[model samples]
Target: MQIVVKDLAFGRINMSIEKDIQQQTFRNSYQKATVNIIFSANWLTEQIKIFLDEEHITPQQYNILRILRGSMKPLSTLQIRERMLDKMSDTSRIVDRLVLKELVEKKLSTADK
Candidate 1:
């Protein structure tokens, strides 16, 4: 009757797909795998959000920063979006926010213009 979620901060590492979702059984391995992937993704996103929250940035913004840092060169917003973990993210808006926060700088691309 108790709901349990994996919380690394409290030293709780054990997690089971069946127990986590309160589903005693799955229809098949494919279904189980799908559900597990979704559940794990959501859990991971939550964890990332917690960390990002501490840094006062959204996941999208964090994704952009990571991409830019790894690229070691300027990338257009389109390029940033293409490399984003969440394709649905509004890359321009996130980049703008980052610019306002002074975490990232935006420059006009002469090549594009």
Candidate 2:
């Protein structure tokens, strides 16, 4: 036996993402998968935004901070940019903001010379 959902109760949105988007059907399996990936990415982004909002940081800054933390040692801006989620992000600007917030410190490395 199989069942199909035609419509879902609006009140159940918290439990049903399909209802939230008012979309439950796809033209093909690939379409469904693509939608799922996009939806998941969006959900993850929103959750991250909410988590960082309390700390007054943008995703780029948070990414840099996380990268620095995991590095266990200070990294150059190029290194930070290489590990960032947005490869095109301006790592130097993000680090500057973080420094102003006292969430990060930037120091010059003479060895790089």
Candidate 3:
């Protein structure tokens, strides 16, 4: 079943997940909610990609920039990777690219030196 409701705050009509995905049935509410969450996340990612594309940066690079911007001090590649949304990304390689772009700089810590 599809439910359409007026969104008072946004002054828009909101459609049910069923209508959005064009699927009318699920195993249960939990399954429906899971699908909704995944679908919403993907939609949001696409929206973000559109904006990020103009800046000539990938989502992973943007993630690193945000991480660095918010940190009180410089962080290592491992630290940045731990805080990244996509942990599986190659943080070192992204950082190297950022260095090439002059978006971020790399420094050797006293301990590493």
Candidate 4:
């Protein structure tokens, strides 16, 4: 799904459309689907960001925490970094922020036989 908005002197108008269509002709008839989807996704992302921003955390940090919590076992920085959707270049830094939030911890495990 996607939405498009245009600003006017008086106000703004928005339009939305789903991606699926019956045929190429139908798709062509709707010229704004791609643009609408891009705008909608961006708008939704920004709204979510506003919520996370209140906690002084970035969107990537929130995702990392969720991945760690889902693991239920200790994960190495590399492991967590590999699984992240955004795949940030600095996984250690992201981990540090989560550690500061007390939502995650780093510890060494005993070697197994």
lDDT of 3 by residue, 39-90 (tens): 8888777767776776678999988998898888899988999999998999
For model 4, residues 14-106, the per-residue Cα lDDT tens digits are: 443443322334346456666566667887787677767766778788777777767867778788888988864588998888788776777
RMSD in order of candidates: 7.9, 11.1, 9.2, 9.8
Segments of candidate 4 deviating more than 4 angstroms: 1-27
Higher-TM-score candidate of 2 and 3: 2
lDDT of 1 by residue, 11-80 (tens): 4755789888999998999999999999988888788788778778887887788888888679999999
With a 3 Å backbone cut-off (N, CA, C), the pairs that clash in candidate 2 are none
| Total backbone collisions, model 3 | 0
* TM-score winner, 2 or 4: 2
- Score candidate 4 by TM-score against the native: 0.68
lDDT (Cα, tens digit) per residue for candidate 2, span 4-104: 22332223225454665798887888887787778867876777677678668898877787787778678998888888889989888888988898888
Q: What is the TM-score of candidate 1?
A: 0.74
lDDT at position 49, candidate 2:
78
lDDT of each: 0.83, 0.75, 0.82, 0.67
Ten-residue stretch with the least lDDT total in model 4: 1-10
Clashes of each: 0, 0, 0, 2
Q: What ranking emerges by lDDT with the best candidate at the front?
A: 1, 3, 2, 4
**Among all windows of ten consecutive residues in candidate 1, which has the lowest summed lDDT?**
1-10
Candidate 3 backbone collisions, by pair: none
Best by TM-score: 2
